[model samples]
Target: MVFVFGVNFPEQRLASLERFYGVGPQLSERLMARFHIHPTAKIGALGGRQITDLNAELTKLTIENDLRRKIQDNIKRLRDMGSYRGRRHAMGLPVRGQKTRTQITTARRLNRVDRKG
Candidate 1:
């Protein structure tokens, strides 16, 4: 299963049925009315070709230029916070939390076997 625009698209064979989860029964029927596959068609046996075509169509319908701008702005905001402290501030995490007695087991060690030798 794959999600696009919060709607789940099951694998190709089940693509039409998957629309039922995201769309109302009437809409689902209207959308897939053209496809006259047998109701007994096994979900796994449904052809993936239709699923791929639907995915392409959904991509074309949902993506917009304003969405592109919003994504670009978010990327710029992240990039502007250059340092770890700046990033922590942007993410609302503690910048100066007490580390006393905290586990250092996972801390990266600068000194390795070669350096020790």
Candidate 2:
């Protein structure tokens, strides 16, 4: 059961042939029609508007622009820090603390590789 705007809706739908206590049968039908609530005999009006609003709120959260700005700002700050060591550490790459003598490998593209080989 869901309550919306101080209105209580039953878990089961109201019978199409039956009349609701406060709302008459015809009035109930009209309310259901206006709100696009399912007319199934077992489930009362589930309040579609409330569900729609909830979905909209979820969409708003997913598309928030402030979160994007914060992420960009953090990346920019990491990039601006002086010194190669600090920059590498901020970017999650191998820093000077790690030994790279024989472990580090560089890429050889077609333009850089020796054609004589």
Candidate 3:
């Protein structure tokens, strides 16, 4: 009776019939008993040894989330706020108003192009 509804006896597959979903524990056990299917019951506490790779998952989720673009937007917002740091960032100058006479040259460096050969 229960065998007709796919009780799954050993490795033998019965006829190709419509599948009946969600059999209760009692019903499943009963069906297993009737069909002579020995259920391999998993006993004892489960040892969770599977570790997820966060870098790969982060890259996958980060693309859809666009976190990199969000950071750039934040930087633009801070620059637009025109705070002391923002002003420095806007002018590409040191925030502490450090003298760039002979120390730093990157920001105040002049490209003296000598065209005389």
Give the higher-lDDT candidate: 2 or 3: 2
**Structural RMSD, model 3:** 23.1
**Candidate 1: which pairs clash?**
13-46
Off by over 4 Å in 1: 1-22, 57-117
Q: Identify the candidate with maximal lDDT.
A: 1
Go through the candidates in order and give each one's C-alpha lDDT. Answer: 0.45, 0.44, 0.39
TM-score of 3: 0.30
User: What are the root-mean-square deviations of the candidates from the true structure over C-alphas?
Assistant: 12.7, 19.6, 23.1
Error of 2 at 69 (Å): 56
Residue 73's C-alpha lDDT in candidate 2?
A: 54
Q: What TM-score would every model get versus the actual structure?
A: 0.30, 0.27, 0.30
Please report, as a residue range, the 10-residue window in candidate 3 with the lowest summed lDDT: 43-52
lDDT of 2 by residue, 55-74 (tens): 34334442234444555455
